[model samples]
Target chain A: MQVFKVYQQETLKYFHSIAILLFVTVGVSAQTKTDTTETKKKPTSFVPTGVRVGTDLIAIGMTRYVDSYKGWEVNADVDFSRYYLAVDVGSWSRDYDNGAEIYSNNGNYFRIGGDVNFLLKDPDRNMFFLGLRYGRSKFSESLQVNKIDSMWNNNPVNERYSNSNSNGSWFELTTGIRVKIWKVIWMGYTARLKFGLTTNEDGNLIPHDIPGYGRTDKNVAWGFNYQIFVRIPVRRQQ
Target chain B: MEFGLKAVNLSLQPRVSTMKKATWFIFLLIIIASCLNDPDCFRINSNVIGISFRVMGTGKSDTLRMYGVTTQNTDSTFYRNTAATGIGIPLDFTTTESEYLFQTTRGDYSIALKYDVNVQFVSEDCGSKYVLENLETTGHTFDSIRLVSRTPGTTAGGNIEIFRCPRTDTMAVAFRQLTLSGTTKSSQALVVETNGITPDFTGETLYGGEKVSIVYLPVNLDVDKHAMVIDFDQVEGGLRKLDLNYTLTETQRYRPCGVQIFASEMIINAVESQYAFDSVGFVLNETNSSIRSVLDPFDPMINIYRCPDLDIAGIYFRNRQDRADSTVSLKSVTVNFQTTNYAPTEPTTFIRVPLNKSATNTTVTIEYQTGKIETLVLSYTATPITRFRVACSDQNTLFTNLAVVAQGTTLVGSQVPNASLQSIPTRNIEIFP
Candidate 1:
């Protein structure tokens, strides 16, 4: 009888183990099926590549000189994907003498004929992407002065002085990292510096810096460009 | 093992059953909610019942003629007394009558009347009724009556004939009577007595029973003259008696006749101090046998007098006809001048005396180099005047030339050619001490 009892106990234990195993197996299978279905339904490659063709690309970021001045800059980069053409439009203004000197070196700018970067990288993150841009850097200055002399005569006399226009332009080159934050949204930051390959005889290039040349006395100029990009998704397939 | 299984199954069945019941309840609730949200899914029928009455006439007397009526279903038209009846029906009813006799049944009915009638509506416990009147009823709800006719003038004393005559005709009376009151007073003396012989010819008299005789006469005095004048000399008097028989007649001879003179451009030439030529003038030629010649020279003269205060300066004349005639004659020409500062406490005394005899139709012209008169006032002592008018312009100041005819004055037959003065000058006259 003791032997019989032991055998019975073994059989009961074996059946219990089998039942437990079956329950676990079924639950896991159902869970796996649900996960597979969800994964199959997920959309892939939601954003199209090279969609920035022929677009006005605006970027905002901190600009730092490799060997000189540093400040925040905003640049508008225009691209012509057909010809791999690019341009940079930007401006910077600073005033002294209570804004009177604002016209001396500040107003509007345009950069023409710049090299395009099909791919860029973020050094710290080892992130890389492709982009294209063509633009130039330009500056305009306008000054005005007015004077009134009442002590010289019984009637007031007025005098006015003005610089209607003064402008300069340069080509630029830009390169940076392209990062993906969302399915269609891309974030990028670039360090761009411009160079004026030519100059006017009025020493207009004396105070300007070139992008690759740093600061040269040879009439070549350079300027810093930094930018952040936002990519918009076009279409997606599930 | 079977019992345990049965128990478990039963519990599960009950749980499912309750769930099913809850689901059914939710479905029912949804159906109800949907029905409430739909505007066209269901219809509600409600009965709106009311009562109205139609009145035959609009006034107080308008016969109710009918009762307990209903409106026509087709067009809501109402029925009247015998002419129409209501199709028997039950309705909510009320009635009211206005103070203007407009009866309203069920407080909503309107009343209309026939003919131009005034009506008043009265609402009582029994029903509503309208009151009407032929007369214009005001202030109260009662009927009114008006009496109308032409009111004759009051006659109190005796029966006296009344007659209407032309407005221009004059009425006169002649009487002869004898009195035994005294011996020294004669009939002629009584005739001169302004108060005693004068008859009170008022339309109203005081005597109740006494009668007086009166004769009707027209303006034409020639048709019956004998009855107008009475001669008291033919009657004798001891106790005093007289014959009083007279006939009435119409005559045009007694009417006051006068002429109008119109002159144009009668200028007074101050530089020449002489009368200018005649420009325009007319002669008023009329005559009456009643107007006896009072002037011994048989010539008519117009007297002119100037007021002492210089405010009035003109001529005056007396009528020589019967005192009853409203006419006067011109005689003894006189000229009275006036000054702006000639202040006299009484009427002025300046007069122009006649220096020549005037023919029947004599024309005379008086010239003044420089003079001024402020205002002119004319007085006549002849028959009482009935109507008169005066008009003057810059070129003519003469009464005849200006067509200024004096009241109670007649224009005899005479022709005066248009005599013109250079200019009728006017000056601001001043008087000196």
Candidate 2:
């Protein structure tokens, strides 16, 4: 009971900070409304009149540091009331040596989805969302198996495997938070749980790693992305 | 108002966001720790048969030098230099036979092994493997054979124990008995050289068949052969023996020991006895394999057995009369074996005998439907059986002058009924000498 209470208290503290931020946003909106009334009395609208575009910071960091990871992604969203239409487009390629085998894959993928903002009336148009995405990747992969015949006196052997233009499609159930720390710029993380991809464990074509959705060796795979965005706000909502 | 409701919902938002971040963090950890792989190997093919020997009797302690030569051995001739510990004879990866000729100071001992060599394709990368299954030794130079393991995997372990031949009479020459079928009862049968019937060595008279010393011929690639000259009393009967030899060659062409000896000429070399040649009573006077008679081969049982890799055991019974040199007629006899349930497809003359038999009591019931016979030591393992049963009913009886004389006085006979297609009936006849 005591631990529960402590946890509840800690949770309540974070909520209080969000409440304080909400009050600041609402207070500014109210002040603007009052000023407009004193001059041209009208309330702000909720409809989004401009687009927000973002680049995945994780992909950028990976590409810069990891020799195998060469990938880039851009995300765009257009909001309408509490719902947003989002599209994630990315291209990735990997070339790595996994001890006994050398694996390489390269392709581009697109994930289009709609996210429903749970906070119906946030002042800064921030979003904490539950989203559903349809993701499809068209990639080709090749792996070469290298082995030594110890019984026959350690003879070295090499076998090459490659598939061109192979593709896969999956569904992602995602949850994300988009928070604005400043004007015209926002940063947040989206965590996705992907499903419905074929899980074949036979042959060299056993999907070891997928480009966009990560490793395909599991029943359900997960992906996470942190993005930095620039928003061009247009007309204010009523 | 709606504004009041929004304010109330705002209090719960921070905790929700905090929890979401924690969940995301945990999921991130899981995502980072995923993707495991199975171990890869360079090679995965297994194939070998391990054979070692344990010497028996007084010479069990003596490390008399030994080595072996297999059918797979390019030169299946004598191995005088290579010593045998437990000779690891590489079976023909393709055949069921892995017979090795182990030549010792005493003589050459032949060990016949049979096993089911099962091969399976592992993968395209690693090729295939030969799995040795049911390793049972039917031919050994000992009292009995025992299998250490039934399935010794793709890599054969040192599980098949070959009890080596006992060093009994090193000074005495080993003799193989051969019979002349169509000769008349005469007083003067000459023991002669291979080319002619001149009395090269005077022979002693014996009860039944003639005996001669075993000859290890020098290896010759181009039709090298051995022979002995036999001069029967009746010239016409000698001619009849020649025809029977020809018939046997044509009929039993696919002999198990792969013996394609031209039985046109025969030889009988002198047997080296430790005692005096005893100016009398020695059938094995002159030994020769060249002037081949129907019974030129000493061990008739040799023709029925195959190498271990073949999953089939065979047995054919030939009863000789007591102390007689000739085989009994196979006219009214039948042979059946009681053993593990055998596949009908196993190529065999005896039915219901498994390729791999346990060290249990296996019975070989030979029914002499027409008459009784004497006791014979069947050097057989479960001591060796097939698909087509070599069974005998009263009507479908096979006729052969096959004689086997037990070196004892206990007369035995097996009377198998026509409907006796199942287990052979056991007989208990005690005869005290």
Candidate 3:
């Protein structure tokens, strides 16, 4: 049911991706069938061969350098033929002080989806892919403000508002390239156009920033991640 | 046919030799990074809802004098004694609903509004602000109300238009003084001091102790005859009586505005008294007089004429360089053997002197703060003329061809630019001393 729910939310966003995915899948299947008929051997089985585990270098660098940001993301993918199932997990926290108010938020998030590799014939097994991701974040936020309303009799108000448990869901249209550098080490960059963000925090203190998503103010957000990965061979690729 | 994963071992990869592609990718990353920006701390929305007052029948903008405007559950008065055709009222951002009460001279009204308040984070320097949206008028006590816009912002026009029925029972009366400039006669507005004016039958004081040239008087809806007792500042015959007779026709012109009472074939009558008025007549729409609309509710319909005072003339001191009226402390002023003393604390630039009507000349003496006395002789010709016709022909004197002779006033002398004297005060003689 959760998977169905995620698919229902992502159907319109993944319309073009789904069409390309079907075309690539059918073409790859036809090629495999031709290879089997010519060799007269056992047919190709669309089973996982290897898995790539990676960490986002940009998130790590921001956590170390940016005072307002503290977060890290781990990305992993497993391949079946030319299609790869991708998963990402991360945690983020922010402390923002715009002089008049102090706002802070922290949470964990995870994104799970699939990627279709276009570079199927690359000798080095490099990848140039377009993918779709369903991202969800569980967050909590608080704000401290000293507000003085001059229109309402010049009364000074000192208040602290918080949303203890808030969660949000979003969609991302992602495109990236992954290239093998040396040995099992790989390098890649993913550019994401994140949009359609919906949050469950209806309280007075709205969530200023989400865990995976940077801020809730913008309708559409952009994200870029440069990652270094290690290829772990599950089965020998033949 | 069956498809399976490749069994080939994908090992170490060869590096691309093109440095241009790598440089282009790095440059693209730099451009995308430059595009990311922090939100600015500026507010583009307003918390106040704009309201325009319109008449029900005419759909024209109308003004109403507001005594005060206050909100429910709050004691703060945001507006007081303001006359406007439109106004901007603030909504409470803390609550989802607010009720505003407007106390006006015409009537009292209340409007309750409901909206959603969304709080958004601006920046670290600006903090969070509440954005009010989905504005709806839940309830109101006006004759008509319409929401022109759902969201309120800093914009022109109004978010709402409030309409009210036209006043059909009020009539404006103006007091006028007649003047003649060589056979071409004109009239100027005359403001009078009144003790009180009351409806004869109801004994309700419509006006009290005020000087006004025009007054809006409320008439009876049931009766065709209306009488009012106007007590003036006159000594002997100050209590003047005036009667109005009109035919009221009830017609359903606009369904939303309901039936309107139109007064027509109006006739005005006054008691014969020199101290009250010289004559009285209808000013506008005399044949088919009716209530136009609330927009022009104060249009004068009747003109009560008073004879001009020819015995009085104004004398003002003038600045030598700028030719402007200059104020001076005075000791006393004697005109035509009548001496009036003024306190040293009271400074004046102008004084009214009673000229001799029988004789063509009058003697005036003025003592300044320095105890220097100056004498002047004023001359004018008073001719009688038929001013206006009410029940009978009225006659009034016109003072013209004015001349002034000054003695012992040495500063810059005096000049009489306005040779013709008028009831309304004017600089007939400008004395530089």
Who wins the DockQ comparison? Answer: 3
Ranking by DockQ: 3, 2, 1
In the range A7-78, model 1's lDDT, one tens digit per residue, is 454454344334433433443344335434433343433233333322123212222222212223333332
User: Per-residue CA lDDT of candidate 2, range A1-238, in tens?
Assistant: 5335435544553453344345434533553354333343345455686688999999999999999789999998988766789999999998776566677888899999998765545567667677889988888877676766443325465556566677778888777677877988998878776778843222334455666787653456667788999988776654
What lDDT does candidate 3 reach at residue B365? 83
Return the top candidate by lDDT. 3
Where does model 2 exceed 4 Å of error?
A: A1-48, A98-100, A151-156, A199-204, B1-433
Whichever of 1 and 3 has more DockQ, that candidate is 3
Q: Candidate 3: misplaced stretches above 4 Å? A: A1-45, B1-36, B44-46, B52-88, B94-118, B133-141, B146-161, B166-433
Error of 3 at B289 (Å): 25
lDDT of 3 by residue, B258-373 (tens): 78776666666555565345666666454675433322445787787766555567888889989898999888787765655422357888887777666788888888879888
TM-score of chain A of 2: 0.75
Whole-model Cα lDDT of every candidate shown, in order: 0.25, 0.47, 0.72
Give DockQ for candidates 1 onward, in order: 0.00, 0.03, 0.13
TM-score result, candidate 1: 0.19
Task: Write candidate 1's Cα lDDT for B1-433 as tens digits.
Answer: 3554222121223323433443343334334432332222111111111112221111112122333233322222233333221122111111111112212241222221111111111111111111111211122211211112111111111111111112222322222221111112111112211111111222231222322222122222223222222111111111111112123322342122222111111121222112111111111116523311111111211111111111122222223343121222222222343122223233332222211112112222222122322222222211111111111112111222211222211233212122111111111111110
TM-score of each: 0.19, 0.35, 0.50
Q: After superposing candidate 1, which stretches have Cα over 4 Å from the reference?
A: A1-87, A97-103, A112-138, A142-164, A197-222, A235-238, B1-433
Chain A TM-score, prediction 3: 0.80
